[model samples]
Target: MGARLDGTVAVVTGASSGIGEATARALAGEGAHVALLARRRERLEALAGELGDGSSVHEVDVADAEAVARAIADVVARHGRLDVLVNNAGYGSMTPATGSALSEWRTMVDVNVNGVLGTTHAALDHLRRAATGERGIADVVTVSSVAGRKVSGPAVNVYAATKHAVGAFSEALRQELGTDHVRVGLVEPGLVRSELTEGQGAAQQAEAEQELGLMEPSDIADAIVYMVTRPRRTAVNEILVRPTEQAR
Candidate 1:
């Protein structure tokens, strides 16, 4: 309930819905001015409206490197600094290797891997600069998944690979930025009730629900808030959260 982020500026990618949307709201609630970025203009606008005065909305596809850089620059130009960056934008498809189209794999790599790179690269300077301010810290929280830690199943082959890549990327960034007080962290979440999971068939959905109890977006949002709100000297490197009933 503490306003640890009061007067800070936070940018959350994939903010149109689910974890991204919830994270944006949570950051704003903690008194951070939030910039919401997503491909869906309507959803971003609606969320911005709901967050009231300290929120700005931008429609952007994270996979577009140039566009992402420009958007991040614009946010810094307007807010003067970016204290937090949440790379929550990602895509997934559950197709086996044998029958899967290369296009699906490419999409996952582009959005899940390259998207994180693009957004993080653009925000790095801003985050580092923010760290030198009164708070003495800045944060980069990337929303990975359980898949990043392990291959849950065959259907998640390429998806898992993409997440794993980002995991490595996060660790490297953490090491490099630690000295600068820019805390780089990763959040790996298990099955959640979102647009991605809702696409599964009824049987799959029910099975997931029965096993994992279906996490709400707010669950992941809370984790993000915890990571960013840590004391200036403490950097929460990683968090892997799963449903109580989920074993894998």
Candidate 2:
């Protein structure tokens, strides 16, 4: 069994599906009381029901700053404390820059970059407080992508840019919060089979699948579980996880 998170209260954004859904399940299984945040009220409610009494559902759009702040505040109020913040809400449309619609790029930046900032900013104080409490530490884990590490191709231009932006933000926050006993970490996943990658017939996608094989969302969730379960004195800074066959 994974290390217990019996008293921890976790907020998982984008919890309706994909990595967010998997992470929420993993955290709850480890004994955390999780707040599931997403725009899909029905999905969130269903997930909460599945998680039983230890979970709460909140309808939220990470792209809306004020709404996100309100949701985080609500979680803190209901739970009395926040122990883990997972910034997993994001969108990506891999269109070549030359032919891509400006709106698509804007969507990517709005959710992947600005959304992370708003959520982090709103949760920072609560996270700091959690760190000083009985847990003795708190965690902020952002689900970035391998695109954050390297620009794969022209098609991933805007998406890669947004991931890179959040990566930089996470690193800076890590440096600043290390002293506060708040661990800021990033999980860079490569080609996990999620809705984001569905329907994209990119050559890169095929190449990735053939080489490294696609990953299950649970694989990434396992990495997150590892990060948060460590002893109070240990801070897992970042994780770069990919399927064994993946070259990049």
Best by lDDT: 1
Report the C-alpha displacement of residue 130, candidate 1, in angstroms.
0.5
lDDT tens digits, residues 39-157, model 2?
99999999999999989988989999999999999989998999999999999998888878999999899999999999999999999999999879999999999999999788889
lDDT of 1 by residue, 169-243 (tens): 999999999999999999999988888998888888988898679889999999999999999989999999999
What is each predicted model's overall lDDT from 0 to 1?
0.94, 0.92
Judge candidate 1 at residue 95 and give its lDDT: 80
Give the clash total for candidate 1. 0
Q: Candidate 2's C-alpha lDDT?
A: 0.92
Q: List residue ranges in candidate 1 displaced over 4 A.
A: none
**Candidate 1 RMSD computed on C-alpha atoms after optimal superposition onto the true structure:** 1.0
For residue 159, give model 2's deviation from the true position in Å: 0.6
Kindly give the stretch of ten consecutive residues in candidate 1 with the minimal lDDT sum. Answer: 206-215
TM-score of 2: 0.95
